[model samples]
Target: MTFPELVVFDLDFTLWDCGGTWCDCLRPPFLKKEGQFFDSDGRHLTLYSDVLAILDDVDDLGLPMALASRTERPDWARELLKLFGIQDRFPYQEIYPGSKVKHLKKISDLSRVPLDKMLFFDDEHRNLADLRPYGVRCQHVASGMSEELFSEGLELFA
Candidate 1:
């Protein structure tokens, strides 16, 4: 398998489902219940079943990873990531409301990885489309992330 210098992911529906909506839509002060995370509104927050394995796959490949979320509440999303115990996985995080092009530019500048050598995944097609001109291999996640999709993204990058 070939590898990109950086593998970027979007939070929201791409990585986790925040009670059937975006993370920003979920009420904050997130809490844990019965080993599961839930928003104050009792909206369940969880990484998709294949998330850990996909992350592990990237780690096993020794590829650097990042997060690019356009959530209105970066703090809330971060809290959930912390609660989910996966925040440390992404050393580079670009969580804010803006074009993913800016996010990828920032990531490229920070990591010194060229845009062409990067792979990005998100639930929204527009997010990926915006990065097309920059040459980043973009994968639109029709649903939550999965090992199969991740493999396909890597293959596309390769």
Candidate 2:
């Protein structure tokens, strides 16, 4: 039943899917329609089906959650997080364009938690690759975030 001190997730295709693509690809002026999120072009934005529950489960575990996204549009990402009503979930967010290694390093410094005690999930292999050398437990998210995938990540961390 061991758990990492912190859990970090990548945005884009990991925590959410922005119309089957990255959020940076979507046009601006994001909107909400009947509780669903969309862009000006009608591209839908949504947290992966299991995202909310997974976040809550992690919170229940008393582990702090953070977001690391190398998206070019940090403002849009933040807006979407607010639109989804999850802007408050992550106390640490590094959404600018850069290596994830830098993001995790900053999170480590901010939380005073070493890299080894953090578990990171990202859809892109290269992103995971960048953090692997720093002793961060990395999970490759194959099809967005799912309960099964999250469970496997916890097992790997343990």
Runs of candidate 2 exceeding 4 Å displacement: none
Q: lDDT by residue for model 2 over 1-158, one digit each (tens)?
A: 78899999999989888998888899989888898889999998988899999999999999999999999999989988988889999989988999999999999999999999999999999998888998999999999999999999999766
Q: How close to the true structure is residue 75 of candidate 2, measured as C-alpha lDDT?
A: 91
User: For model 1, where is the 10-residue window of minimal lDDT?
Assistant: 24-33
Best by lDDT: 2
lDDT of 1 by residue, 96-135 (tens): 9999899989999999999999999998989988998889
Q: Go through the candidates in order and give each one's C-alpha lDDT.
A: 0.91, 0.92
Q: Which stretches of model 1 miss by more than 4 angstroms?
A: none
Give the CA lDDT, 0 to 100, for residue 131 in model 2: 88
Question: What's the CA RMSD for each of the models?
Answer: 0.9, 0.8
